[model samples]
Target: MASRRHPLATFFHLFFRVSAILTYLCCDWFSSSFVGCFVTVLLLLSLDFWSVKNVTGRVLAGLRWWNQIDEDGKSHWIFEARKVPASNMAATEAEARIFWLGLIICPMIWIVFFFSTLFSLKLKWLALVIAGISLQAANLYGYILCKMGGDGDISRVTSSFLPQTVFQTACPDDFQKPGLEGLEIHQH
Candidate 1:
């Protein structure tokens, strides 16, 4: 049986994502300055990006991703998944569901925000809207690669433009734990 899911990991998986959304939605009530609202939303988005990329996804869903540049100046996106073990993997069904749903849904919300902002001609808000969409969409794309065994091309044009390399990593003994796995995930 899988080890129990870490509640903290589940909490973090939702934390920044929710915080960023709420901050973007309610920033005007709290701060009147455009710069203040922009910076806060961006900071929350950055935190969401970092935490999702480096921490919660691995613990909750056994996935990690990064980009590598070859000596020739070409970029390769690498998506890695933890090898399935003889025993069940650490992620519980609920935890994995939470991770994936949160991963998938947030970007969709941002897309709705994008169109709403565009149609309203809220030109000043467009830059922040784009940033939110890009950051969330990147995670959604990376994790979907891991979930699908990392084989699918992101797109033919993207593949031709940037290239991609996918590999599976050995599941570390303490795969369910959070701290040291960050270093191992980046290892080729």
Candidate 2:
């Protein structure tokens, strides 16, 4: 069977991905003022980050992340994974692939621009290039975490610096209560 995504998920996935590239080009190629272009690209990058992290990610792949502060003022990162198992997660997998692929490609484009500016000694564009790369890297990190089951368990560890938890309250297979075997209820 083929995997499929909701129409909106498909829309936003393409929108955010294409917008990132277009915004970068517009700021770099069309805008006359360096400061103005930098600010515009920064704003667009921020919008992409928020939309991907909050809206499209949840709608398409059912994943999200947030941070919490403890009494000691230490920060803990939490990743929430919807319990859609692999067997039944074909659609989610497809959506995740789109999200991840876009994230990967977007950063590469920025990296190219970064090098082009560096070699040409166009130091004015330095800040904008770095900021774009940083934002894309952050998005990539979240995508990786989502793929790793969001439990901070990418590998076995004997010790850890940060605390993590995986709450599995929404497993699709465990949603129903078991009853007497062979018992059935009928309604009129």
Candidate number with greatest lDDT: 1
lDDT per residue as tens, model 1, 1-188: 44555888888789888988899889889988989999988998998898999998877777888888999998877777765443444445446657777876788888898999899998798899899999998887787665554555657533532221111122234234322222223322
Q: List candidate 2 segments past 4 Å from native.
A: 1-4, 85-88, 150-188
lDDT of candidate 2 at residue 20, scale 0 to 100: 61
Query: What value of lDDT does candidate 2 attain over all alpha carbons?
Result: 0.63
Check candidate 1 and list the clashing pairs.
none
- Global local distance difference test of model 1: 0.73
Q: Give all candidate RMSDs, comma-separated.
A: 8.1, 10.8
TM-score of each: 0.75, 0.70
Off by over 4 Å in 1: 1-4, 84-91, 155-188
lDDT (Cα atoms) of all candidates against the true structure: 0.73, 0.63
Error of 2 at 55 (Å): 1.8
